[model samples]
Target: MLLRRGILWLTLCLPLYGETVAGRWHAAVKTPSGEEAYFDLEVNHSGGEWQGMLINGRDRNVSSAGSFDGRKLRLEFNYWDGRLEADFENGELRGAFTRQSRKQVLARPFRARRTPLVSPASAPSVDAGGEWILDVGEGGGKEMWLASFEQDGARLQGVLIPVSGDYGMHTGFVDGNRILLTHFDGIRATILDARISDGRLVGTLKGSVSAMVTGRRPDKAGRQELNSSSLTTMKNPREAFRFSYPDLEGRVVSSTDARFRGKAVVVSISGSWCPNCHDEAVVLRMLYDRYHAKGLEIVALGFEYTGEKERDLRQLRLFAEKYKLPYPVLLAGTTENAQQTLGQLRNFRVYPTTLFIGKDGLVRRIHAGFEGPSTGARYAALQQEMTQWVESLLAE
Candidate 1:
């Protein structure tokens, strides 16, 4: 009866296990590199399935779900550029995340505790309205542009307009003094020890792509100057290039058209898979609304990852449907050869590039990446300056 005695002892320990996991538990999470992060948790029972969500520290309402089994937990979700799977045990949570061509594991220990529902006063009143800018070193380093933060009930979420590239959206919430934000690049970060002061949200925001970058109010004059210089530095305005792409209906649209007569044109080289392109599309829509009556037309050329030309066109059309694009989109070849597809175009490396052709049919500007209107105060100033530039060009 020795085996029977062992079974009886195991049954007694199971009751203690059940008691240990009767309530909810939470913790601040981060990747090993300390860039991507989130607020994670589990609500479980000893012998029952446990369920929880990993909330975006920046945008509280943006969350993904997970499961737990008493002493163990696993979370599966998507972030800006990667997929995540975290494991939890005892009073700690850790795991590995993979994306693009990289992989990362949880290097640090995350302490687990029960997170009580924060009252209204404890939540952050982040007036993210003003223009914001992120400076993340060089090499076209990572940068974020936040337009504003919106509140709904006890929840908060904001849109992030990226300046560096076409990273989809950065959404999150402000839990007490902590900021939990996630990017479209498949990464998340929690900025602990945050506080508001002087009508601006001042705090250290962390991420997997960069270190603990600080967020603050953007300077107006500096932003204006930056925009002016960036827009005015076009070295080759006399350059001319040819473009031929098929529209959504399998019809070919080219740069050399008799209807062009003497009018300026904006050609957008983008794809539906890009988030930066989304921001650019919205801003372009706004501009088109203001200037389409002035004989200005925009053509969106999508270079998608899918090999089929028809599939690429459908995807582009879907993206247009979702965003209510006002311009006509064309599908280029699916060879991943953007420069080749542009025929005689040069220096075409970046995606979501914009080519501004003057009334004379000569390229005036080749903007490399799209910095949406919501990046922050700097982006606002940039938009104002850009509007003036566009008006001047149109008047000329």
Candidate 2:
């Protein structure tokens, strides 16, 4: 009789349990400078499990694997092994977003409230909705960025494009003369707090790395900086490109394998943490599927942040699984050791540097980086250009 009563009581409270995690969240992580880097999430409880999504500028990456056992919640951002765990407390959820490697566990304090209303700013003092130049770092460490923005009323959406690639999108609001933008995509977070003085935008970029950033209107000379696609090249262009690395199963896959002989091949140098590399993977899979039967092949040499073999392989596998890639992705080395990993390559300035090798086994074309869909024309142009490149190589 007592057991029956407990079962009936639990059934009555099931709807209340569902209400605990069924709303949108405004999540924040504390940066090193003590500023909150923000992102949004929307979670739903269905089929007796909790599913959520990490909301970035133009991406809603869904967490298909997670659980909520009444009071505790865990969400897995499996695309890159980003995880979030929290507990219900005082009408809010408190937790830590974490990433793991064999050597360390990196965690950041996290807290979230309900998604709040979007209020327009009092008065917009400047239109941050066009092309500009953002310079980050100083001296040899400096990189020039192409800032493209879109403004509607007081809300602002923008992206910073560098010669290497873009950092995706940043969304914020313009209040008076100051503009604040924040982004948290599970693995990394960024807070851009800047104010307009005269005609220049000056601010500090805070997150994993802190630096002062400056922006200005670009002149004709500054516009020429974007033409950098052909700069990276091989130390010996006449020599055929070759590499040997281990796949996930410890099988050494080499460029000189019989399978690639007399066939057009594409070699991709990418990393686990690179957003641009992730974008390039999708197009690669489509091309492989379309032309694999017509003597075309592709391979990705993954250089990762962590040097531990297990952790790096896991990330590489997850990246491959996300795009359902059929090609062999091999572990090359840590990002810092890329020069040693690819001895013949020079001027490697980006995470994703694609090499187009003709049937003669010599690399004929190289693209420095890839910009995703958010960059509009550049993204479309790369896809079209590469498709034609692949066709020409196969034709040869």
Candidate 3:
């Protein structure tokens, strides 16, 4: 009887063991490679329920699917397929946190505390302003990356662009001659660190993995810019874009459908696991709302990481429902087999390859990758530029 009473008392005490995790926390994941990523976490507990948000710059990702057993806490992202499982002890939340992407199953050691880390107050030693041409190492797959920075005093804001896509907006600072920048949306986290060495900047982009990258200021004596429009091209530009796929409901949707016959169409080739694609989706929503009634038709070709049709559809449905997308999204295929599945395009490298089609049913322009809101001014300009393209096609 005495032993049973002790066991029952221990169970009862477990419920009261965890302290209230209801405050702003400074959270970070230190990967096995010693690289680190941080994000602002705001948690609230009310009515015996716990919820929170993972904040990265201007994005606030909601975590509503949660459970707290007093000692252990598990919170799932509202839109993405990522979760945080932590134990409350020593006045800190410590556990393994996965990347927000459904394809990302690797969990890293995540720790959070009430206090935030302080940034260095020293002034920058160098001005990291203007466009840079990066020559990535062989391990990264991509040969080049275009990066632009806006620096104000010691603070730095920028976006890293690859041939296929971009690492969303980054917020960081220049410590002496070193540049540090980071971006953590609900989907992924990318940290950049570079140092000036002999009129050149060299660094490594690190997250769950690391890749060496070296860059230099644009030489006016050569190609000053990387044209994203020229990256992915149709094997035969004279032919129109064509595809037939099923949506979440399993109904076939074809490019030849009468609904799109006479309309100026925008085809977004993207994946559910891609963060930059999410950024592009937000802008697509705005453009669809404005020009949808003006003879503009938009469709999304979803290529997911997992080939499982049912699970991919679930994620796609959540993405559409969360954004309240007015257009149809078709599951084309798996991301790994995209090049083979989308046989018409050969140089396909990125998640979000946007193709604009005129009323005549021909692809007018194919813009590879997207500049999301975190890109600041570039994002604003992209909206105007895309709108103008649509307007011109509609006018025809």
Candidate 4:
């Protein structure tokens, strides 16, 4: 009887034992550039000690790990091509944290609920699959812009393919009578917030948000041109201007170089603090190396997170050196908001934006996001199509 009572008492104390900042938590990191990243941290207690692992956020997967020592929390996660440190509030398991290199602030820290992390809704029985046009609305019921959504239900995890834009992985979920789909541009927002009606879902949106996104999910029709416009013509020329910045070796390079004088120059715009940029950078490097001899030169411009130009340069240097980037990388600025950084300089659209600078120095094909090979047959075909574009440009 005494042993049974002791066992019951220990079981009741288990919850109290984990009161020292030692449990799962949901965290979001916001870059000064206005990009929000999501993360799920699993913290475990062993021998009165705590440790953690960060799940997927932005382009980073489950490879992130860290330790919590009462007041000081230290975590290492990959960003761009370098590992970044995240420091938690010394003693508390909650509160705002900063990415060391970029100084991006991650606020609204909260303990993750231990309940099943499922959406509080059901999947509608409609064939929400296939490519459907998306028309976002603003106040007064005005249709703002056009985009696309590809619903695979399983693979590709259902993505929002914006028309002539790019904000990678626009995910959706259905709750009760409402259908909610969202993407991050430094914060989580309801890109689509329509409730289920007769057959479809309808809702309002935040307009300024979509203007910054330029991602697209290619249709699986086997390298077919969905849009007839050549990737080398500047549809928005006046808004786009050309500039130059120095690479790590003090080499001053610009979008107006003779090497890219008459060729299609691809300006790869991304931040060194971005995980998605890592994959995009590798692929861009491969494409640049494979096609440079054939009138193809990629100028990678990094919009890093440091508050100072020198720090931004250093971060960019680290990324370039680590990735062995053969292409020239210029430092844009340390600002986190893309609009403030590029909106004033040029008509910059999105991160990981590939601006195809034509022979006339005019912006041409602007491809957004890198749908890696693992994304399946569509990605493979997309790769082939892009390669074909390069081949055509080379022939020109």
TM-score for each prediction?
A: 0.54, 0.89, 0.86, 0.62
Shift in Å, residue 12, candidate 4? 13
Worst 10 residues of 1 by lDDT: 224-233
Error of 4 at 141 (Å): 11
Q: Rank the candidates by TM-score, best first.
A: 2, 3, 4, 1
Q: Quote the positional error of residue 389 for candidate 4 in Å.
A: 2.0
lDDT of 2 by residue, 97-192 (tens): 887633567788888878542434578897777777888877898777777778888888777777767666777888888887777776657878
In candidate 2, residue 191 scores what lDDT? 75
lDDT of 4 by residue, 1-396 (tens): 999999999865544444545566555444333433444556665675445555432322332445554344554443322222343443334444334444754442333334323353555544344443444544563322333344444211244433233344445555555544444322232244455455454555442244222222234533323231332234356544466777767788776567767887777777776544665677778788898887788778787775576667777877786678888888766546656645523444445666666666666466655554323454566667677766766665
RMSD (Å) of each candidate, 1 decimal: 9.4, 3.7, 5.0, 7.3
lDDT, candidate 3, residue 53?
81
What TM-score does model 1 achieve against the real structure? Answer: 0.54
* lDDT of candidate 1 at residue 364, scale 0 to 100: 69
Candidate 3 segments exceeding 4 Å error: 1-19, 46-49, 99-104, 117-124, 128-132, 138-142, 148-157, 197-199, 218-225
Assess the local accuracy of residue 191 in candidate 1 as a C-alpha lDDT between 0 and 100: 35
In candidate 1, stretches whose alpha carbon ends up further than 4 angstroms from where it belongs are 1-36, 39-182, 185-221, 224-236, 343-346
Which candidate, 1 or 4, would have the higher TM-score against the true structure?
A: 4
User: Roughly what TM-score does model 3 have, to 2 decimal places?
Assistant: 0.86
Model 2 CA deviation exceeding 4 Å by range: 1-16, 101-103, 115-121, 220-228
Candidate 1 per-residue lDDT over residues 106-185, each given as its tens digit: 33334455553222456555544334454433456544443345555435445444334423334455555554444422
Looking at model 4, residue 38 earns an lDDT score of 41
lDDT of each: 0.54, 0.81, 0.79, 0.52
